[model samples]
Target chain A: MTRLSSAQRHLVRFTLNGKPVQGEAEPRLLLTDFLRQTIGATGTHVGCEHGVCGACTITVDGELARACLTLAVQIDGCELRTVEGLAPAPDRLGVLQAAFRRNHALQCGFCTAGILMSLDHYLRAHPKPSEAEIRDLLSGHLCRCTGYTPIVQAALEAAAELAELSRSDHRDV
Target chain B: MKPAAFDYVRAETLGEAIEVLAQHGGDARIIAGGQSLMAMLNMRLARPKVLIDIMRLRELDRIDSTSGSVKIGAGVRQAALLAWPELATSLPLLSKALPWTGHAQTRSRGTVCGSLAHADPSAELPLALVALGGELHLRSAGKQRKVAAREFFAGMMATARADDELIEAVSFPSGNARCAFREVARRHGDFAIVACAAVATKDGVRFAVGGVADVPTARDWPRLEGSALDDALNGFAHELDARDDVHATARYRRDLVRLIGRDLVREVLQ
Candidate 1:
């Protein structure tokens, strides 16, 4: 058993956004703080620290997780992806981000980071998701802006675009 | 909100975790998924001196069905169980209720045993356990014991589990016991204001209600119809002793228990 006392910070190493990162965290330090403060990946926003708002949503080992609910020390040796990893390039937006822009999916943008992360992970698994399915998935996220209609539209449009891209890629192959 | 400072222990084995629990007792909290506990920690509802991470205990992640019951281990997350291929056929009640336990994000990390350990009155898992007559397998450093779901949950946020004992697994009996579930909540993933689950029994149907009582309570009834069934449901609803809270009023809960209870029992019976 590896026991770290609460009196001091301990070394925590993990892969963030496909890049290796290390930090020091006390036992009580949440992963949300670690990502933003220690790793300086501020794209993962924190809305409700109690895991209700879903603003801290991210992927740990490819599975969607609430960063606030996860302790920083517990994420050692795991592959994590945050909202920072969503866009393929810093200068350009990804397909989903572009879709959100076109559909006017976000307003305040406090909840967009988490919603995008969730949709990114969800759309990958469900390429042909129905509007109801997208709505159901979005239930985890609480959005005050756009009333979620545009968000759903953006997700469906993105899914269709991704499917078309995949089909075209297969043809080229 | 931030959690109070605590020591962290990543147990390499079940014996190690049990030993730590045996030493620290109530001061030590075992964390698998931390979906519920983390919230408690952040809100300072649970301030343990030591948080034991049992997620690394791969041996405890099994979902065994060889014994004719679906035995889910402690490390088995809610999403894993929901994604189980035989879940719909083997444990239909869980299939209907798991989606209501939490959202997809939290379910990916929330464990089945963890939810039972939290023992929230409005949680769907405990209600399903009680309605299905499941068993909770608890272990300490010295010994292990199996607890009936009905007897295991003592009250809201409470259980019969000793501080030194960790829930190893929970087994739900797999059979064609026609069952149905329904919950009334403000949001899709919010805690239920009133949730009901019914399963066909030998003589009749057993109705289990959550979010109204301090604990999920189940009562079995012989086949009855019309006003007779209505009377039984009314009695059961009153027996829950619900109170007016921010989410719902006592009268509203009682009405739900009677209305949803009647619907679930009918569905299961048919």
Candidate 2:
């Protein structure tokens, strides 16, 4: 068993959005703070630290999780993905982001990063997700803006686009 | 809110975790999935001097389905149980209620044993466990014991488990009993305002209610129909002592008990 002192900062190393990253964190340091403060990746927002708000949603080892609920030391050596990893390039928005833009899914955009991360992970597994499924998946998040109708539309559209892209890639292969 | 400073230990084995718990007792807390515990830590509801990480204990991460019961280990996440191939066939009630436990994101990280450990009055897992008449396997450094689901849950956010004991696993009996689960929440994946689970027995159905009382409560009844069922549900609802919270009124909760309780009992019995 590996033990770290609560009072001292420990070296935490993990793969961040496919890149190896290391930071120092005390035992009480939440993954949300570690990502935004230590690693300097502010894409993963921290709204409600108590896990009720889905603003801090990210993926640990490719599984969707709330960053606020996760301790930084716990994710050691795990592959972590946040909203910053969504886009393929600096200038290009990913398919899901583009869909959100087209559908006007986000208004204030506070909840967008977490929503995008969730949709990105969910759509990959459920490429043929129905409207109800999208809404169900989205229940984790709370958005005061856009009334969720546009967000649902964007998720469905993104799923279709992702499915179509995969089919075409198969054809090309 | 941020958690108070505490030492962290990533336990490589169950034995190591037990040792740590033995040393610190109430001063140490077990972290498995850390869904509920982390939330408490953030809110400073629970402040342990040391946090033991048992997620890495691969031996504890198992879903062993025997012919009689489905035993879920401490490391079994809510998502893993939901994804289990035999879950629907073995524990239909869990399959129905697991989706309502939490959102997909939280479910992916929340452990089944952890939920039972938290023992939230309105939580689905504890209700399902009680309704199914499951057994919780608890172990300490020196001794191990099995506690019945009905006896395990003492009260709201409370269990009979000792601080030195870690819930090793929980076993739910596998049967062909028709089961039904219904919940009324502010939103999907939210904590249930009133959750009910009914399981058909030989002579009658076992009805369980959550969110209406301090702990998930169950009542066994002979098969009844129409007004008889309604009267029984009403009596049970009153017995729960539903409280008025920000999400709902006590009367509204009792009403749900009568309405949703009737629906679930009938669905399972039929």
Candidate 3:
């Protein structure tokens, strides 16, 4: 078709946490809209409606992707992890989250979810990134409150905690 | 806030994607990461009637170094390029320019082919690729052709991509050469207002400046040293046709062209 076509595409089925969920959406429907409106997973917030804001961030098949900029139809068989799915099970406040809370990393809580999600991945990839590296990585995210000191501290503390845990595990070995 | 409705086709293979493009024609858009495409789609700036999702194209997602050149698949993500080892040793300029991309999260999904295809005049990768003398492999339904980096970039947001054609890969020649890049932008991760990539080869010095002119302008000066080099650079700086944009003025960009060009060539080459 010369003009854009709207089709009632097949239901998109995917896993949230360990459960399978299905929903119907058009090719143009955004994954953020699908998550918020369909499943009511409001933890993934929408800020810029573009990829600029980290608020609508989520983990698709373990990789961080902006839900706001992704199409719902694209996630047919992928596994998604949202903030709601993250909690004490991975250890209370999840290390990064707990560190943020302990260090008072958030204030207004608007950009926290996105940063938390992104930091989750960043910390996993780089357990102990330097103060400069933390700042460099966090440069991808926006934090309006805490002036980034506390957040950066939280990330720093999380790295230390992760290092300790790694040492403990190695000692156990 | 939502993108316009479009016909979605998840191509199972590269041939299918090309066929779909041939049938659907110009209104069809191929999306890899959708990092750049989705933004334009949402703003209604790009309302492609047919959206071809090429995320599953396995062939276009490879990065391999063969012979002396590095063959980066069109779908090779930006993060992949940053992680590639040869590009670092063979072309250090590409490595240095990697951080100037959008961000880590965006780089995780953004593809090299898409960036070259989008051909933003001021972007780092394109300028680096041009300076390195990369060859873009463009594939159509029945034919595939390679265009040199010098001829690939037409202008701002413009490239040599043709209708019913897709970028197969981009290959840059390998050499024992030194390279450097300098770009001044509004913010750290923001697009460049003016960027230049300079290559110091055994032959001579090549200077390519983007975000200052319509298309990338390259100049190869006769090897000069001392005051002669400074005088030539000053003359070239005064002769550029820079434009005024929201980020910078024509005058500021022109001066940057001279300063950065001189800085990179003199420091890296000399």
Candidate 4:
């Protein structure tokens, strides 16, 4: 059998953080590599390339996925969200980010981005998650520092803040 | 580690996918969710000349429920099955077992049929399929066949699926049986050291044990009360010949199978 040359590349177009993005990559290029190198979205870290660690977790088409395990070409027409997309503005952090900071959820900050991204998507579906449910979500992630106490606290606070913001928006309308 | 270079072809239909698989034969591998295949490829554990991406075959992504059975397509993601409300009622054992297969992110892209086809002995899907008395539908270019879950899984990471055959769907018998799933793992989403799935019917109970044998094993038990059931469970556990692994000793696994088996059986019976 003939082997495909590593130099062979394919053109891929997708929506990244609500903006159209296009790049050239090999069919074997992982989404984590494409995001970090091609599109320059380095917030999605590659901890364990085998998908055991959740550091490369991102949202593909609004669903949480491990970028390291997903092929770049497979998400050709999908919308993707990385940790860079989580901030509401350049000057200020997003609600979850602010809560993370307030709760001191980071020590080394390596696993923070992926944890934030996972919780960002999780809290959307479960705005009022119980403590048990929060722990269950955190089970997908691995954090060596902070012992997860602060991270869980931050998630709970963010959920409350997000819920409060939605309530206020409804009141104003 | 990065995966070795491989050509990719996205098939627009099931027929096209089958034709490509036949043409490439052993050189090509079908990829649905890429949850398991990608990991293998990255580790250089598997390297094929071509990857036949079948995610575009939307025709193989439906979930159909008919009188006492539910057919889940090969492309149906694990998370989709978990979220499907009908599954809770139709296949209660599967619903209880899916969450333990992997975390939310992995389940979001992992396919139910892919997990079964991968045939990992410690995987929750195969154990649940065996306990539920499921049948897998395998299709080639012009021929198709159904294999029982018990017979389909030959051993760890092995199945009866031929090189040219694709798993089109898996049909599971649905019933009003009470069910329970229990597994002891290092973490919540990790592979189980010993996993047991039990489905209790009015007549008796069907018990399946994973991570303790070459392949997941299922047995039907008649209604036996008190010491009779305990003695039977002990004998069944001893028959497994559970092997020592990095995670556990053979004796530990046997003990877990006995203890967890009785607990799960009792839970389902209740």
Mind giving the per-residue lDDT tens digits that candidate 2 earns over A65-89?
9999999998889999999888878
Task: Count the clashes in each prediction.
Answer: 0, 0, 0, 0
Measured by lDDT, the strongest candidate is 1
B99-206, model 1: which lDDT tens digit per residue?
Answer: 999999999999999999999999999999999999999999889999999999999899999999999999999975599999999999899999999999999989
Lowest lDDT block of 10, candidate 3 chain A: A1-10
TM-score of each: 0.98, 0.98, 0.92, 0.96
- Angstrom error of the Cα, residue A128, model 4: value is 0.7
Question: In candidate 4, which residue ranges exceed 4 Å CA deviation?
Answer: A1-7, A170-173, B201-203
Candidate 1 chain B, which ten residues in sequence have the lowest lDDT sum? B171-180
Which candidate tops DockQ? 2
Clashing pairs in 2: none
Clashes in candidate 4: how many? 0
Alpha carbon lDDT of each predicted model: 0.94, 0.92, 0.80, 0.88
Task: Give a tens-digit lDDT track for model 4, residues B1-270.
Answer: 998888888888898888878887877788998888889999988898788888778899999999989999999999999999888888888888888998987999999999998888899999988988889999989999999998899988999999888999999999655889999999898889999998886688988999888889988888766898788888888888888889999999988988888888888777
What is the interface root-mean-square deviation of candidate 3?
4.0
Q: Against the correct fold, how does model 2 do in TM-score? A: 0.98
| Candidate 4 TM-score, C-alpha based | 0.96
Model 3 docking tier (incorrect/acceptable/medium/high):
acceptable
True contacts kept of each: 0.94, 0.99, 0.50, 0.61
Q: Taking the tens digit of each residue's C-alpha lDDT, what string does model 4 give over A1-173?
A: 21234468778899999999999889899999999999898899999898888999999999989999998888888999989888767887988999999999999998888899889989888889998888888888899999999999999998888889898884210
Please write out the lDDT profile of model 3 over residues B1-270, one tens digit for every residue: 889888888887888888888987789888998888888888888898889888788888898776778888877889878887676786677787888887787888888888888887777778878787889998879989999988898877778788788888889776646778888887566678888888876667888887776666677876667788778766766666776777888888777886787788886666
Better of 2 and 3 by DockQ: 2
Q: Ten consecutive residues with minimal summed lDDT in candidate 2 chain B? A: B174-183
List-wise, what DockQ does each model earn? 0.92, 0.93, 0.45, 0.51
